[model samples]
Target: MDFGSSLGPIRPRRSGRLGDTVVTYLVDRIVSADYPVDSALPTEPELCEEFGVSRTVVRESIKLLEEKGLVRATPGRGTRVLEPPGWNLLDPIVLEAQIRHDRELKILDDLISVRAALESDMAAATARTIKAPQQQELADQLDVLADLLDDAGAYAAEDVAFHELIMVASGNRLGHAIIHSIHSKARLSSRYNGTPTRADQEQSMAEHRQIEALIRAGDADGVAVLMRTHIVGSWNRRRPEVHRSLTALPTVE
Candidate 1:
């Protein structure tokens, strides 16, 4: 790798920590295939010189990369980039890098599938145990969604809020945390959000209404199926045509 040209010096402006900035830089390079799997990374001295950081910062950044399963540093062999399968995809920084570099949309597709699975179950649980107050909450949220139909950006934000309400109603903290972490990062990718037409927003709102109705009626199975279908179908509609061959979740009947 051309450390001087391709990878520029780190700026003086501090973000969180110097180590974090360096980690982000290296993670982007590794995930983007600038440093391919099985290839050794630049030496510590080279990295230190390139980023203009001290040896301590570089070493700590390397340790952070190892913790994320991005690279392995052997005493005699230097650091070697690891395969994607070994990566901690749940880590926010690593996941963001992967999503940013995902040209074929495979990572986004898989992200939707995982989201569908977890959120569907959460929806079902909410439906089964939701009280009258919780049902009213969802109904009010649906109203808010309907009102925002004209503003796609605001509607998109509320769309996430509506789903989060359901997840909270389900009382599944772990599930909520996992989805929140991944979805928060995934939303930063343009491919993940896509460009929603007015018709698309209307369709999504309609699905939200149906989901609310099912939850109100305590129809767990129906809500689960609809939630899964809604998520995967939304992704299908927005996904680029060229990469449609990638596997997607099947909608439950």
Candidate 2:
């Protein structure tokens, strides 16, 4: 309700503009259901006074929220928050908000499924076309993973890099973008859970090693199978209570 201290006077910044800060605050509130669907946002005058900004900044922020399908503005009726289905989940801002605060864990499940499908094809493509230098790059990442077995946080970071390299090398720019987006957002959430045990880390490393070997051998089928297995396996190891079969993942043509 109070945006005074929260969305205070926007200082001069090169990166996050004044409008962006307000947009982020409003998106967070909407995603958190603090502004439930059909609920009216604070009036323009109220927001201007609360954030110590002119009507221009407040109006721009509200416009942005509307563009992201988060709200509907009417002349007589104030801006009304919309339902989740109306939101643009693929939009980076909205996705980050969901990842940072969604408690239902549904977003995490969707992320895993998407990653599994895309990485399977990426792995296949990488295996078929990867050059020696890229292969070495992947090998180097594996070495880093092995060395960081004792450090979960560092290991997880390198692990993402390892896969990111493959996605890049696969020559699928769009796929890489989507996967990277998911990774960047997940890293900020509880969903990016890393291996917690020495044994678990060892298993993850083994899977990466196998995938690397398949790529070196140019075994596309093997690469696809192992990549999906590794992805799903990692998820299971991290959250044993949650099990979702990856068998339904379509094979890369």
Candidate 3:
């Protein structure tokens, strides 16, 4: 393995969780795609050395990694990265970093564009394949958003749920992965953007209702358009206003 890129520091979190150190470093390498798909993974002993953790800790770390569909371990072959199918792109932790820490988003150009595309495709795929019961699940999420206008955390949670339910209902693996992958981003963006005014709240809820309806009706194209518009328009509309408010000086003439 190449070590040209900085390995930086690997400290076990104070939480004293058994595998935190190994987990953290492995996460970085995996997300960085240093552990290419289908490639054999470093031995648990190797990770133990790099992380200075016990063998048991490394075992636990590998277990979690495998659970996330990142790797497969055989008796003799050792652990290896799974092909594209094994990866759960929609994993919340993964999406959180992608959305919040993505430096490219500083300009809000192409990064936002990637998010927009993800939403569009996700909604469309959900609309195409979501079944009756799943549509009901999506509707319940809409009800939550409608009733709870003040609880930002609750609202955000439901928002992620809505997308997850829709993605599952749509019955598309990749679409499910996309929504899962960006699930945290959708929530974080909502939280940072915070509770909107009554007017904005109504408009947002109505938009969600519209998407839900389209999915129930199996209108893939329409749901796709509505979801994309809502996501892009949100960042476009709010971020600028936020920037101006933060940067502007208050003056009394």
Best by lDDT: 1
For all predicted structures, in order, the TM-scores are: 0.90, 0.87, 0.54
Candidate 2, residue 228: lDDT: 90
| Model 2 misplacement above 4 A | 5-16, 240-253
Worst 10 residues of 1 by lDDT: 244-253
Model 3 Cα lDDT, one tens digit per residue, 12-130: 55434747545655655665456777778789777777666778888888887787777888988888887655555456544443344333344244445766787778788877777
Which rank order by TM-score, best down to worst? 1, 2, 3
Quantify all predictions' global Cα lDDT against the true fold: 0.87, 0.82, 0.65
lDDT of 1 by residue, 35-113 (tens): 9999999998988887778888889999999999999999898999999999999999899888877767778889999
- Candidates 2 and 3 compared: the better one by lDDT is 2
lDDT of 2 by residue, 11-81 (tens): 66533376787788789888877789999999999887766667888898999999999999999998999
- Model 2, 66: alpha-carbon shift in Å? 1.7
lDDT of 2 at 10: 58
Candidate 3, poorest ten consecutive residues by summed lDDT: 244-253
lDDT of 2 at 38: 93
Residue 165: error of model 1 in Å? 0.3
